[model samples]
Target: MNSASMHPSDTNVGMMLVISAPSGTGKSTLIRRLTTEFNAFTFSVSCTTRAPRPGEVDGREYHFLTREEFLRRREEKYFAEWAEVHGNLYGTPRQTTMDLLALGRDVIFDIDVQGARQIKSNMGQGCYVFVFPPSRDALEKRLTGRGTDSEETIIRRLAAARHEIADSQWFDHWVINDELDSAYQELRAIYLAEKTRPAYRASWQAALSRQWGVS
Candidate 1:
């Protein structure tokens, strides 16, 4: 059906896309390319009690908050999902996400397994994708090649990655980042397909109803 033929309200159906992956799976790069190539996609900025990294701006990368403020907001249930990672508290703002969805903007989340689980429990609708490296050896090479972590830290992260990948079985889709271009194409395909699902396009049902004179 031609979306242009439908009324604004009828065609304005939004979606949420959640993506999670192991630390060295290059998940961030895939998400970056998707958001860059799609104008309709909005990356959800999370709230965090951690200090902003150099060159990170407020409300862009994260909504930086004090520890006390983060806790207060948590208590008020302002976050859809909140988790403490590596001693810092991070959360997705509940109202902001809902408002974006109501406006027909597809929101993309770059979160971890813990955050993904919370989001699944709280909001049952959304396409969840998990990215994986081709092999554990590749993941270790990627992590070690970065030269940012100590050997001990790298070992710990590898163990964490195994657990994260195990939990990924529940995700709707999985993209193996063996080749960057191929992996990105698969990821984009998932997003495009999900967008076309009848459940996500309310206008299809409305248009059909009008044609059948069901109202």
Candidate 2:
């Protein structure tokens, strides 16, 4: 089998890369870089009941929905995974995600731990990664430095960070965002390695089988 001839685009199955981290752990930045660098990776835009932030566009950053609409969709099981975070309801649309995967597009998720747990339970496959800050002080500094949250909200987020980190033990990989460039490299490597997994390489296997005259 000439495995070297197999290209990434030849893969018939896509990967569900689920990533979770505390609010200030730089998870969003990493995901942005990944999707930008690797054009094949698709960012799963989630539906959220929270109002869009300044300069955030609807259907780009999130599919902004009213609380009533969100609840109605939740009851219909329209979301692959949904959770309440910071008092806002957020959910990943079920059909959209499955359709992308069916088309062999690697979908990446930027969600909280609760959402990640729901995804793991509902879908047993895919890779789960947890991002951690270098230290407690660093996390606090980042949260406070944002200046977007009130003092009370910052404290609440810090507390939630602890809980999220504790629950992250079940993740398949953990990346510490001490240095942005180094962390990005490590994350990129993980995705590249995951692409080689047997489940994602059905086309490659078929090509090999044909070369060997196997049924």
Candidate 3:
């Protein structure tokens, strides 16, 4: 009922962050480390039209869906944001995040720049952070070294990455993944600092902070 408190509608003021990086730049690894290290933050799972890769589970790695099902959801306007990448459609459904954050849990998204923009615009509580590698060459080597794509495909990806890398400024913070441990520490610091933002801390009032040993 008060403006200083979380609006009766909006929730999760700890800061919802969008973390992005060029392919093979270790964004996945960083996200894993981040979620594991910070008990309060969680990686938000996405929904996609692509089939699950080996070892990926349904509703975990991604919410795998048929193209028809994906388009049907699109028609219903159920996605917070959606994109077609490499011939497959990927999206983040709004409800899962809404439910989690409504319960006072922080949500972290490993989405691309475009998705990040959409979510930031739609969800005012969210923040965007870009995890960047040192150089184009390093990104190239990292992707190719995995042996997942052909030389031609890698070239195409690198070209695409150039544009994405330029888009980092579109985010609130750009943390370079040049040194893994250092970057992780810095990202963790952002979490700590965001928690102290007056707006965010005020959401803690008494109940939520009590869960984390905060006043």
Best by TM-score: 1
| Tens digits of lDDT, candidate 1, 46-161 | 89999989999999999999999999999998888999889999999988988888888999999889899989887778999999999999999999999999999999999999
Task: Give the runs in model 2 whose Cα sits over 4 Å from its true position.
Answer: 1-5, 48-73, 85-88
lDDT of 3 by residue, 1-215 (tens): 34444442233455687788888788888889888977777656788989788999998889999999999998887777899989999988887778777666788888777888888776666767888888988888888899999999999889878889887786878888888999889888887776666565455456456455656
CA lDDT of every candidate: 0.89, 0.89, 0.79
Per-residue lDDT, model 2, residue 133, is 97
TM-scores of the candidates are 0.89, 0.85, 0.78
Name the weakest run of 10 consecutive residues (lDDT summed) in model 1. Answer: 2-11
Q: Cα RMSDs of all predictions?
A: 2.5, 2.8, 6.1
Error of 2 at 39 (Å): 0.5
Worst 10 residues of 2 by lDDT: 1-10
Question: Candidate 2: TM-score?
Answer: 0.85
